[model samples]
Target: MAALGQHAVSKVKNAESQLVQEWIAALEASGGTRNVKGDELKADTREFLQLITSSLENGAGTAIGAAQWEDTRQFLERLSRNRAQMGQDSSQTANFIFALKGPFFALLQKEFASEPQLLAEQLLQASELFDALGLHTIRTYQASREAVIRRQQEELLELSTPVVKLWDGVLALPMIGTLDSQRTQVVMESLLQRIVDTGSEIAIIDITGVPTVDTLVAQHLLKTVTAIRLMGADCIISGVRPQIAQTIVHLGLDLQGVVTKANLADALALAMRRLGVTFTKAQ
Candidate 1:
C-alpha cells in the first residue's frame, strides 16, 4: 500500500497541536477517556501524534510490523498495557487510536481539497494505518489482561494454602479446596519452605475443608508428603473423614508409612507430643 503522501504528512505535522486537541475532544466525546487522567491523556495524545508524523516521514508504511514503525509499535504496546492495568476494556483502548481518525481525516480533506485522487489515496492509506494500530492495541490489551489474571491466580494459590507454625517445631497447612496438581505444587513449596525456615520437625497436612478425594487427589497428597520427608520433616495426613477413608479404601490407595489423623486437633496433639512441647493449665 502507498505511504501517506508528503502533503498529508506535512499537514499533520504543521497542525499537530490542533490535531491533538481535536483528537482528545473526540475521545472524551466517545467516552474513551472515562477513567484516564486529563493530563496523562493529553501527554499521550501529543506523543502519539509526534510518533505518527515521524514514522511516516521516515518512510514507514501502513504495515505497522515494519522496522521503520518499531517505535510506534512499542509505544502502542506500552499504552495498551497501561490501559489494561487501569482496568480499561479493549474497545476503550482501541478507541484511544481510532478516535484520532476525526481530526486526521479533517486535516486530509482541507489539505487535498483541490486534488480528488490524492485525497482518496491519502485517506485510504491513513485509514488502513489507523486500523492496523487499533488492532495492535486490542491484541496487546488482551495479552496484558491475561498476564494480570495469571499473576493473580498464582497469588491466590499462595493465599489459599497458608503454612502456619502451630508450635515451635510443627507447621500446619490447612487446605480448603479441590486438590489439583498446581495447588499441590504450591502446597509442597510452601510447606517445605516453612519447615526449612522454622526448622520444624513435623508438618501437618489438614484436609478438613477439602470437599472430596479421588485417585488424582490422593496422588497429589502423596507427592506433597514425599517432598516434606525429603526435607527431613515428618508429614502427618489429617482430616480423614469417614467418606474420605472409604474413598481411599475403594481406590486401593496406600498410606503404609504415612501417619494419619482423624482431625486437625488430633494431628496437632500428636505433633506437640513428638516435638515435646508441653502445656499446663494456669493454677
Candidate 2:
C-alpha cells in the first residue's frame, strides 16, 4: 500500500506521458495493438495511465476490488469487451494490461534507484495490481465471448426453423435439425406469431431434413400441434418418410388426432384443398 503514498504516486504522475508511450510500445511489440488504430490505442493507454495514477493518489491500494478502483475496473471491462468483439482471445485482451508491467517497472526502478528496498516494494505492488487487472480483463472478455456465442445460437435456432407462407391462409415451417425443447419453443413462438399476423388457418410442420425422431421429438410436435389448435389454426405434420413411418410404428407413438403428409408438395396441395383452392392443368 505504500506505493499509494506521495513519493511513488508523484513519480508515476510526473512520468505518466512517457509511461504511456513506453507502454504503448510494449503493447505493440506484444501484438496487443492488432486491429486497433494507433491513435485509439494511444488514447486508451493514456487514459488507463491516468486512471491508475488517479487511483493511487486517491489511496486505492493493490486490492483492485475496492470501491476506489471502480473506474479502473470499468475501463478494463470495456476494453476487454471491445477486444472480445474484435475476435481477440483472452490472452490478447490480458496482454493489453500486462504489457504495462514493463514500462511501469522501469519507471519505478529509475525513480527509486537510491532506495533498493522501496523500489522492490513498489515493483511488487505494481505487479500485483497489474496482475489483478489483467485477470479481471480476462474474465470480462470470457463473459463477453459467451454472450456472443449465446446470441449466435439463438440466431441459428431462428434461422433453422423458418416459417414460410406457402399459400393463402397457409404457412409452412421446414425444420432442418434435431428437435430439442429450446428449438421447439422457438418454433412455437415463431409459427404462432406468423399465424396471428397472417390470419393463416393452416401450418405445415415439415421435418424431412430432421435426422431422427425419438419420443422427445414426437412429444415436441404434439405440444406444438396442441398450441396451434389452441390458436384456432390447423397443423399438418409433413415429411413422414417410410423409414420415419416405420420408426413411428416401432415406437408406438400415438398420433391419432394429428394429420400427417408425406412431403412438402402433398402438404401444400392438401392445405390448398382445405382452403377451397384448386388448380387447373393447361395444355
TM-score of each candidate structure, all chains considered together = 0.93, 0.95
Q: How well does candidate 2 score on lDDT at residue 156?
A: 92
| Model 2: lowest-lDDT 10 consecutive positions | 1-10
Tell me how many residue pairs clash in candidate 2: 0
Q: lDDT value for candidate 1? A: 0.91
lDDT of 1 by residue, 170-259 (tens): 889999989899889878887888899999999999998899999899889998888888888899999999999998999999975789
lDDT of 2 by residue, 1-283 (tens): 4544578889888988888888888888998889999898988998988988898888888899999899999998999889999988888889998998998888888888999987888888889889898999999999999999999998898889889998889999999989999999999999999999999999999999998998999999999999999999999999998999899999999986899999989999999999999899998
For each candidate in turn, give its C-alpha RMSD to the true structure in angstroms: 1.7, 1.4
Candidate 1 lands at a TM-score of 0.93
Candidate 2, position 151, lDDT: 94
